[model samples]
Target: MHPALLEIARLGLHALPRASAGALRRYLETARPRLDLPPGEEIELFAPGARAVLARAFADIHHWLGQVSGRVPFFADIAQIAVPRPIPELAAAAAALPLLRADAPGHLADEAALAFLDRLAL
Candidate 1:
Protein backbone atom coordinates (compact mmCIF):
# COMPACT_ATOMS: atom_id res chain seq x y z
CA MET A 1 0.00 0.00 0.00
CA HIS A 2 1.04 3.58 -0.46
CA PRO A 3 2.63 5.35 2.50
CA ALA A 4 -0.13 7.91 2.49
CA LEU A 5 -2.88 5.31 2.87
CA LEU A 6 -0.99 3.59 5.63
CA GLU A 7 -0.82 6.83 7.52
CA ILE A 8 -4.51 7.32 6.96
CA ALA A 9 -5.37 3.86 8.27
CA ARG A 10 -3.22 4.31 11.34
CA LEU A 11 -4.67 7.67 12.12
CA GLY A 12 -8.26 6.66 11.55
CA LEU A 13 -8.04 3.45 13.54
CA HIS A 14 -6.44 5.20 16.44
CA ALA A 15 -8.86 8.09 16.44
CA LEU A 16 -12.21 7.39 14.79
CA PRO A 17 -15.03 5.47 16.44
CA ARG A 18 -15.53 2.11 14.74
CA ALA A 19 -19.28 2.37 15.39
CA SER A 20 -19.56 4.78 12.52
CA ALA A 21 -19.56 3.23 9.04
CA GLY A 22 -19.66 6.67 7.53
CA ALA A 23 -16.22 7.26 8.94
CA LEU A 24 -14.99 4.34 6.88
CA ARG A 25 -16.20 5.81 3.60
CA ARG A 26 -14.56 9.10 4.38
CA TYR A 27 -11.46 7.27 5.40
CA LEU A 28 -11.32 5.41 2.10
CA GLU A 29 -11.62 8.63 0.18
CA THR A 30 -9.14 10.55 2.30
CA ALA A 31 -6.69 7.70 2.20
CA ARG A 32 -6.51 7.87 -1.56
CA PRO A 33 -3.07 9.03 -2.56
CA ARG A 34 -1.97 10.28 -5.92
CA LEU A 35 -0.36 7.37 -7.70
CA ASP A 36 0.36 6.10 -11.17
CA LEU A 37 -0.89 2.58 -10.52
CA PRO A 38 -0.24 0.27 -13.43
CA PRO A 39 -3.04 -0.89 -15.69
CA GLY A 40 -4.35 -4.46 -15.57
CA GLU A 41 -3.21 -4.93 -12.01
CA GLU A 42 -5.96 -5.75 -9.57
CA ILE A 43 -5.35 -3.51 -6.58
CA GLU A 44 -8.30 -4.72 -4.55
CA LEU A 45 -9.91 -8.08 -4.01
CA PHE A 46 -12.53 -9.15 -1.46
CA ALA A 47 -12.61 -12.64 -0.19
CA PRO A 48 -15.96 -14.27 0.57
CA GLY A 49 -17.45 -12.99 3.84
CA ALA A 50 -14.88 -10.22 4.17
CA ARG A 51 -17.24 -7.27 4.13
CA ALA A 52 -19.69 -8.91 6.52
CA VAL A 53 -16.92 -9.52 8.98
CA LEU A 54 -15.99 -5.88 8.64
CA ALA A 55 -19.55 -4.78 9.23
CA ARG A 56 -19.78 -6.81 12.39
CA ALA A 57 -16.47 -5.59 13.64
CA PHE A 58 -17.40 -2.00 12.98
CA ALA A 59 -20.68 -2.55 14.77
CA ASP A 60 -18.77 -3.88 17.80
CA ILE A 61 -20.44 -7.23 17.49
CA HIS A 62 -17.48 -9.51 17.96
CA HIS A 63 -19.40 -12.62 18.98
CA TRP A 64 -21.71 -12.32 15.95
CA LEU A 65 -18.83 -11.52 13.69
CA GLY A 66 -17.27 -14.73 14.81
CA GLN A 67 -20.44 -16.80 15.26
CA VAL A 68 -23.08 -15.76 12.70
CA SER A 69 -20.33 -15.55 10.15
CA GLY A 70 -19.72 -19.30 10.49
CA ARG A 71 -19.56 -22.46 12.52
CA VAL A 72 -15.87 -21.74 12.97
CA PRO A 73 -13.59 -18.84 12.31
CA PHE A 74 -12.59 -18.51 8.65
CA PHE A 75 -9.75 -16.00 8.57
CA ALA A 76 -8.12 -17.46 11.64
CA ASP A 77 -7.51 -20.72 9.76
CA ILE A 78 -4.79 -19.20 7.60
CA ALA A 79 -1.32 -18.43 8.82
CA GLN A 80 1.51 -17.48 6.48
CA ILE A 81 3.25 -14.16 6.16
CA ALA A 82 6.49 -12.95 4.58
CA VAL A 83 7.89 -9.62 5.65
CA PRO A 84 8.52 -7.04 2.96
CA ARG A 85 11.55 -4.82 2.54
CA PRO A 86 11.96 -1.88 4.93
CA ILE A 87 10.52 0.58 2.45
CA PRO A 88 7.60 -1.66 1.62
CA GLU A 89 7.02 -2.43 5.28
CA LEU A 90 7.04 1.24 6.10
CA ALA A 91 4.66 1.97 3.29
CA ALA A 92 2.40 -0.92 4.22
CA ALA A 93 2.44 0.09 7.86
CA ALA A 94 1.36 3.55 6.86
CA ALA A 95 -1.23 2.57 4.28
CA ALA A 96 -2.77 -0.13 6.43
CA LEU A 97 -3.65 2.00 9.43
CA PRO A 98 -7.32 1.28 8.80
CA LEU A 99 -6.74 -2.21 10.13
CA LEU A 100 -4.77 -1.19 13.17
CA ARG A 101 -4.75 -3.21 16.36
CA ALA A 102 -7.03 -0.80 18.19
CA ASP A 103 -9.77 -1.39 15.62
CA ALA A 104 -12.60 -3.78 16.49
CA PRO A 105 -12.74 -7.14 14.72
CA GLY A 106 -14.86 -5.80 11.84
CA HIS A 107 -12.51 -2.89 11.43
CA LEU A 108 -9.60 -5.24 11.88
CA ALA A 109 -10.47 -7.03 8.66
CA ASP A 110 -10.45 -3.75 6.85
CA GLU A 111 -6.97 -3.14 8.23
CA ALA A 112 -5.87 -6.57 7.06
CA ALA A 113 -7.37 -5.94 3.65
CA LEU A 114 -5.64 -2.60 3.46
CA ALA A 115 -2.40 -4.26 4.43
CA PHE A 116 -2.72 -6.39 1.32
CA LEU A 117 -3.52 -3.31 -0.70
CA ASP A 118 -0.45 -1.61 0.75
CA ARG A 119 1.78 -4.38 -0.57
CA LEU A 120 0.22 -4.34 -4.04
CA ALA A 121 0.42 -0.57 -4.17
CA LEU A 122 4.11 -0.60 -3.47
Candidate 2:
Protein backbone atom coordinates (compact mmCIF):
# COMPACT_ATOMS: atom_id res chain seq x y z
CA MET A 1 0.00 0.00 0.00
CA HIS A 2 1.22 3.52 -0.65
CA PRO A 3 2.20 5.17 2.64
CA ALA A 4 -0.09 8.12 2.23
CA LEU A 5 -3.02 6.00 1.13
CA LEU A 6 -2.46 3.46 3.86
CA GLU A 7 -2.45 6.17 6.46
CA ILE A 8 -5.72 7.54 5.16
CA ALA A 9 -7.36 4.10 5.17
CA ARG A 10 -6.08 3.41 8.66
CA LEU A 11 -7.66 6.60 9.84
CA GLY A 12 -10.98 5.62 8.28
CA LEU A 13 -10.81 2.23 9.92
CA HIS A 14 -10.30 3.77 13.31
CA ALA A 15 -13.13 6.20 12.86
CA LEU A 16 -15.78 3.80 11.61
CA PRO A 17 -17.97 1.88 14.03
CA ARG A 18 -16.95 -1.74 13.92
CA ALA A 19 -20.36 -3.14 14.79
CA SER A 20 -22.21 -1.45 11.96
CA ALA A 21 -22.47 -4.45 9.69
CA GLY A 22 -25.31 -2.91 7.68
CA ALA A 23 -23.31 0.18 6.92
CA LEU A 24 -20.26 -1.85 5.97
CA ARG A 25 -22.25 -4.18 3.73
CA ARG A 26 -23.94 -1.32 1.96
CA TYR A 27 -20.66 0.40 1.39
CA LEU A 28 -19.10 -2.72 -0.10
CA GLU A 29 -22.08 -3.52 -2.33
CA THR A 30 -21.94 -0.04 -3.77
CA ALA A 31 -18.17 0.07 -4.06
CA ARG A 32 -17.38 -3.25 -5.76
CA PRO A 33 -18.96 -2.66 -9.19
CA ARG A 34 -17.86 0.94 -9.19
CA LEU A 35 -14.29 -0.17 -8.68
CA ASP A 36 -14.22 -2.89 -11.35
CA LEU A 37 -15.75 -1.93 -14.65
CA PRO A 38 -18.27 -4.11 -16.41
CA PRO A 39 -16.55 -6.87 -18.39
CA GLY A 40 -15.79 -5.95 -22.06
CA GLU A 41 -15.86 -2.28 -21.18
CA GLU A 42 -12.24 -1.68 -20.15
CA ILE A 43 -10.47 -2.11 -23.49
CA GLU A 44 -13.17 -0.43 -25.54
CA LEU A 45 -13.61 2.45 -23.11
CA PHE A 46 -9.92 3.06 -22.61
CA ALA A 47 -9.03 2.53 -26.28
CA PRO A 48 -6.68 0.06 -27.98
CA GLY A 49 -3.46 1.74 -26.84
CA ALA A 50 -4.41 1.68 -23.15
CA ARG A 51 -2.00 -1.09 -22.30
CA ALA A 52 -2.20 -0.53 -18.55
CA VAL A 53 -5.95 -0.79 -18.12
CA LEU A 54 -5.79 -4.18 -16.45
CA ALA A 55 -3.39 -2.88 -13.84
CA ARG A 56 -5.65 0.02 -12.96
CA ALA A 57 -8.71 -2.24 -12.74
CA PHE A 58 -7.04 -4.62 -10.35
CA ALA A 59 -5.76 -1.84 -8.13
CA ASP A 60 -9.29 -0.64 -7.57
CA ILE A 61 -10.44 -4.14 -6.65
CA HIS A 62 -7.58 -4.47 -4.21
CA HIS A 63 -8.42 -1.17 -2.59
CA TRP A 64 -12.10 -2.08 -2.23
CA LEU A 65 -11.28 -5.48 -0.73
CA GLY A 66 -9.03 -3.89 1.83
CA GLN A 67 -11.71 -1.41 2.80
CA VAL A 68 -14.44 -4.04 3.31
CA SER A 69 -12.35 -6.56 5.22
CA GLY A 70 -9.28 -6.53 7.41
CA ARG A 71 -5.82 -7.16 5.94
CA VAL A 72 -5.56 -10.90 6.67
CA PRO A 73 -8.86 -11.89 5.08
CA PHE A 74 -8.29 -9.50 2.19
CA PHE A 75 -4.90 -11.01 1.39
CA ALA A 76 -6.16 -14.54 1.87
CA ASP A 77 -9.03 -13.96 -0.52
CA ILE A 78 -6.61 -12.41 -3.00
CA ALA A 79 -4.44 -15.54 -2.86
CA GLN A 80 -7.09 -17.29 -4.92
CA ILE A 81 -6.75 -14.71 -7.74
CA ALA A 82 -10.49 -14.05 -7.51
CA VAL A 83 -9.77 -10.33 -7.44
CA PRO A 84 -6.64 -9.38 -9.31
CA ARG A 85 -5.40 -5.82 -8.88
CA PRO A 86 -2.34 -6.32 -11.10
CA ILE A 87 -0.26 -3.95 -9.04
CA PRO A 88 3.28 -5.22 -9.60
CA GLU A 89 4.53 -5.02 -6.03
CA LEU A 90 1.35 -6.46 -4.55
CA ALA A 91 1.25 -9.23 -7.15
CA ALA A 92 4.86 -10.11 -6.31
CA ALA A 93 4.31 -10.30 -2.58
CA ALA A 94 1.15 -12.37 -3.11
CA ALA A 95 2.97 -14.78 -5.41
CA ALA A 96 5.83 -15.31 -2.94
CA LEU A 97 3.72 -15.86 0.15
CA PRO A 98 2.46 -19.24 -1.08
CA LEU A 99 5.97 -20.47 -1.85
CA LEU A 100 7.75 -19.06 1.17
CA ARG A 101 7.59 -22.34 3.06
CA ALA A 102 7.48 -24.80 0.19
CA ASP A 103 10.46 -26.82 -1.08
CA ALA A 104 9.52 -26.14 -4.70
CA PRO A 105 12.36 -23.77 -5.46
CA GLY A 106 12.50 -24.83 -9.09
CA HIS A 107 9.29 -23.10 -10.07
CA LEU A 108 10.61 -19.56 -9.87
CA ALA A 109 13.36 -20.15 -12.43
CA ASP A 110 11.15 -19.85 -15.51
CA GLU A 111 11.59 -16.49 -17.24
CA ALA A 112 7.90 -15.81 -17.57
CA ALA A 113 7.25 -16.93 -14.01
CA LEU A 114 10.05 -14.75 -12.73
CA ALA A 115 8.66 -11.76 -14.59
CA PHE A 116 5.24 -12.38 -13.08
CA LEU A 117 6.72 -12.64 -9.62
CA ASP A 118 8.65 -9.44 -10.13
CA ARG A 119 5.40 -7.54 -10.73
CA LEU A 120 4.01 -8.52 -7.30
CA ALA A 121 7.03 -6.91 -5.66
CA LEU A 122 6.40 -3.53 -7.24
Best by lDDT: 1
Q: Identify the runs in model 2 with alpha carbons over 4 angstroms from their true place.
A: 1-11, 19-22, 37-85, 88-122
- Model 1: lDDT equals 0.41
* Candidate 1 TM-score to native: 0.23
Global CA lDDT of candidate 2, please? 0.35
Give lDDT tens digits, candidate 1, residues 1-122: 44434444455465545643335445455433433322212222333455455555544444456677874444453221121123333444443443432243333345544443344322
- Per-residue error for 75 in candidate 1, Å, reads 21
lDDT of 1 at 85: 22
- lDDT of candidates 1 onward, in order: 0.41, 0.35
Q: After superposition, how far is residue 120 of candidate 1 from its true place, in Å?
A: 24
Model 1 bad stretches (over 4 Å): 1-4, 19-83, 91-122
Q: Residue-pair clashes per candidate, as listed?
A: 12, 9
